[model samples]
Target: MRKLVVLLLLFGTIAHSQTQGFAKSSDGTPIFYRTFGSGKPILIINGGPGMNSNGFEALAKKLGEHNLTIIYDQRATGKSKLEKPSEKNISMDLMVDDIEQLRQKLGFDSWIVLGHSFGGMLASYYTSLHPEKVEKLILSSSGGIDLELLNHRDLVQKNLDKTYRDSLAYWDKKIRKGDTTYVTKLGRARALAPAYVVNPKFYAMLAKRLSQSDRALNTLVWLDMNRMHFDCSEKLKTFTKPVLILQGKRDIIPAELAERAHKVLQNSRVVLMENCSHYGWLDAENVYFSEIGNFLKP
Candidate 1:
């Protein structure tokens, strides 16, 4: 009876460690994070200058099956809150610092870093700031190491016909008028969903995820990034660590952007997924995971 009780207690403690929790950032802001699986640590940063980390939960779980995967809400998104989310509280430097602080709290001296979309930009910035702390770098549908992505017209928007554009405009007006209900958000997301995925079937899922974004944070982050002229290309040139730039051929973000990153990153490799869009995992699940799995292998 005593032995069984001890074993059960041990299992409970292990389970607690694998679940979700908060890590206080440098400025004492509690950053919400969730962990999955067990092995080498891999921190997955979701995009959205103001987006929460929930959208990456499925990806994290898949990665977690082989390694310890960590996903956290950025400073002001999801469960992570800031007392006053002003320009002073949020900046590119602060965002990078938050990742470092989380790393310290998590006790990982160095670990794999994976960033998706805008999250890839954050990961690049983080790597630029602390190259030594990153064992490997994975940029999935990344936004490149510079701000050039903003210069290009959104392919998704361009492809959208007048009807979709009109719908988007309608939702934008509602959102601007402070109607931030899920319905309004979902409506906005649905309008943009078609461009996000290659298959129409995944449109609803993509829209659901897109609707969860925190617009204020997104705007704030972009504002800060633009002010700082966010560019890590020079720093990445000096980084000799292994980097995997995985992008989809048909992604709204053009393939040339990934190629440009590959050129600047000294020790980087680019893998373009044919027929896949921004979300390669959804568009080409087997190939996506296979490439990631192989790259991460010892």
Candidate 2:
């Protein structure tokens, strides 16, 4: 009976244990990563070129219930900070390399890759570079496979009233001028928050997450992408792995972008959630989890 009790305790501890650490990238940048559960690995890449991995912790824990869920701060964000932020240190190629380094450090020959928003673009780029390292690809409210998404005006701009737009412009100017204080960041995040979800209740939560973004890093990535003419369409066409494209019908990123990717990816499925915006989990929770859970099932 005592042995049985000990075994139960051991199992309980194992079930809840979380592993976290930093993995050195090719350029020797320490990328922070955390893992939950245990099984086939699924790396959850959160949105934002400059946002840290904190916003996805809840989502990671939920997915971790069955699969070994991994979430990491991309270089120059959260715990994965470079000694100095520069175009040379941070770029599309280097960012992709960081993901590869993390995979190697984790000892994953190949794993399921799930990326959200901007992360979708990054994941698609990563798959294009290293198709053999990806078992499956899941894009959630993705930014699409090319820079075409940038040509369209953000839904946030349309959703904002003159007052909010003015506020956003003001804060943005301040941020660009090297005034990235908490107040400045929060101001910009709040002004742009409404367009992120259909439900108003989630605005504050989304705003808080957005406020944590690193503006300088975000700029660096965008500049680098422009310099390299970042486009994954050609490479994505050659990828034969299973791909799932999940987008909210009412998202800031248009449905056409998702469709474009669907047409490009050889073996891809696209699901559009109704009454949802940029965030499907927050706006259409059931549909979001259901689609992903079903897709990831063995």
Candidate 3:
């Protein structure tokens, strides 16, 4: 019995948060989550609000070597359930609550929250609601909810590439002329959006998966996030947790916004991935991992 007990303890301590699917959200959405390693918990909030739990595969592996890394498919994305589109019921606040619920369910009292793009905005709101729960904050290719920065992003997109520039011009002309289904025909590959891909191999894999996706959740969530345009600059200043802000200089999001956000944070550091695009994880994986590891280190 003593030997068996010791063996069980060792397994429990060494085992990663065994990747599992569980029913946590009260609304009946089955959130899928995965984890590896065992240390300070790091929760990764994926972009798109509708993006799946897959993009973080590379990131998880790197971080999982030391820290307990947790990534979940948000309520309406991936394998999570979605509700009928409505006005008041589906709000960002609810999404925040879901994160809190997931954390509580996972037996974590506190966690390092990571948000990328829309996820970053979500994290800002999250830190506001539960400042005490966040051990640290990491924002990647994102900033506080500033719609103006998106306009700045538009200008930056103009100088990206000759082909890309012309395509945007054409798309803009069509959209301005009342072409509602513009992106549907042009596809994501033609827009300023596609320039964000840093790795062709990864891009190809995503493209294949995207083509096979049964739902338009990712695209819809992106539009919803833009339309929501969550403004929490006031709340951003209230975050007491140490923050690490990351942005790509060549990104449409613009690294300057990250600098501005860094100023508002209580204790924050900005990491500009030079000449990289929005997909800094793949664009500058080594730098990103090193920086993240440094920030989380004891």
Candidate 4:
């Protein structure tokens, strides 16, 4: 049975005042969430097929200018604590259901959705399932449904240092074996950090962020997604709502994918960031947010 879990902070006076806690998912997972700003509602879905959403905190703050932004750690990630960890519990269906439930529980008629990377893929799927629930859709550096088509594993591996690449086989084995140790998780992030960012200076920042995250690399979830290879291009083709596609010119995801997405979603607008990589907001903050502001204007 699903239950709503509310955790109250008793130690710190300031922390207790914040309206943040967990919402128990159907399979009895506690999903942590926080709300920022106040206006039209907008939920920012982060990438990282299994990475925590807390890393987008600063991005959420920047987007709060005209919307009540919502950010949350997906199940088994960040502050979302799970009683029992299993790949079976990490399906895309469950993840999308969690978003719908969160929306209903929060009492929003409908709201804007901005998804980055894997989060963008999830947002697209969510729109396909429940078109009436999404006001606008923003897919940033997200690929289409076919997991194989989105495969940049080669790029990621090539970008890693020789030593890291040599150790990857060992790390992959440990991850597949369900080793949730901090070292294993942090090591994986460090190895892939180079492929995700263009700025070398941000490499340390990325490593530090991953190190601090309540990291849970659910390898099975990734494996299952690739196996199923779901595609929702047909649904997107018929989607009439406003859609925006954002991609970085230097991102490993490839700008062609975003352009293809724009073609599939007829009403979508595409924005390609110059001199930027995967993390456009980090590499070109001002331009990134400015484009978002313009696109959001009525």
Winning model by lDDT: 2
Q: What are the per-residue Cα lDDT tens digits for candidate 2 across 1-298? A: 9999999999877765699999999989999999998888999998898999999998888888878999999998999978899988999899899999999999999999999999999999999999999999999989889988888876778766798789899998998898878988888999888878889898899899999887778889989988999899998898998999998887889889999999999899999998999888889999999998898877
Candidate 3 lDDT, 124-198, residue by residue in tens: 888877889999999988745555455564544653577767766786676567664625434433444456665
Q: What lDDT would each prediction earn against the true structure? A: 0.88, 0.90, 0.72, 0.77
**TM per model?**
0.91, 0.93, 0.80, 0.82
TM-score of candidate 4 against the unseen true structure:
0.82
Ranking by TM-score: 2, 1, 4, 3
For candidate 4, write residues 1-298 as lDDT tens digits. Answer: 1232222233222332225666667777777888776677888998776678778888887687566788988887778866565767878888888898788778899999999988888899899888899989988788654464455556566555697677766777898899868898678767666767877888777876655544345565666676667777888788899998888877778667787788889789998988777888888878788888887887
The deviation in Å at residue 49 for candidate 1 is 1.8
Candidate closer to the true structure by TM-score (higher is better), 1 or 4: 1
lDDT of 2 at 108: 91
Write down the RMSD of all candidates, one decimal each.
3.3, 2.0, 5.0, 7.7
Q: Write the per-residue lDDT of candidate 1 for residues 1-298, one digit (tens) a residue.
A: 9999999998655543567888887888898999987889999999877778888999998888778999999998889988778888898888888899889988999999999999999999999999999999999999889988988776878757789889999999999999999999999999998777787899898899899887777888889988998889888889998999998888888888899999998899899988788998898899899999999988
After superposing candidate 2 on the true structure, give the runs of residues whose Cα lies further than 4 Å from its correct spot.
1-10, 161-163, 166-170, 173-179
lDDT of 3: 0.72
The runs of at least 3 residues in candidate 3 whose Cα sits more than 4 Å from the true structure, single-residue gaps closed, are 1-17, 153-156, 165-187, 190-194, 198-202, 206-229
In terms of lDDT, model 2 sits at 0.90
**Clash pairs detected, candidate 2:** none
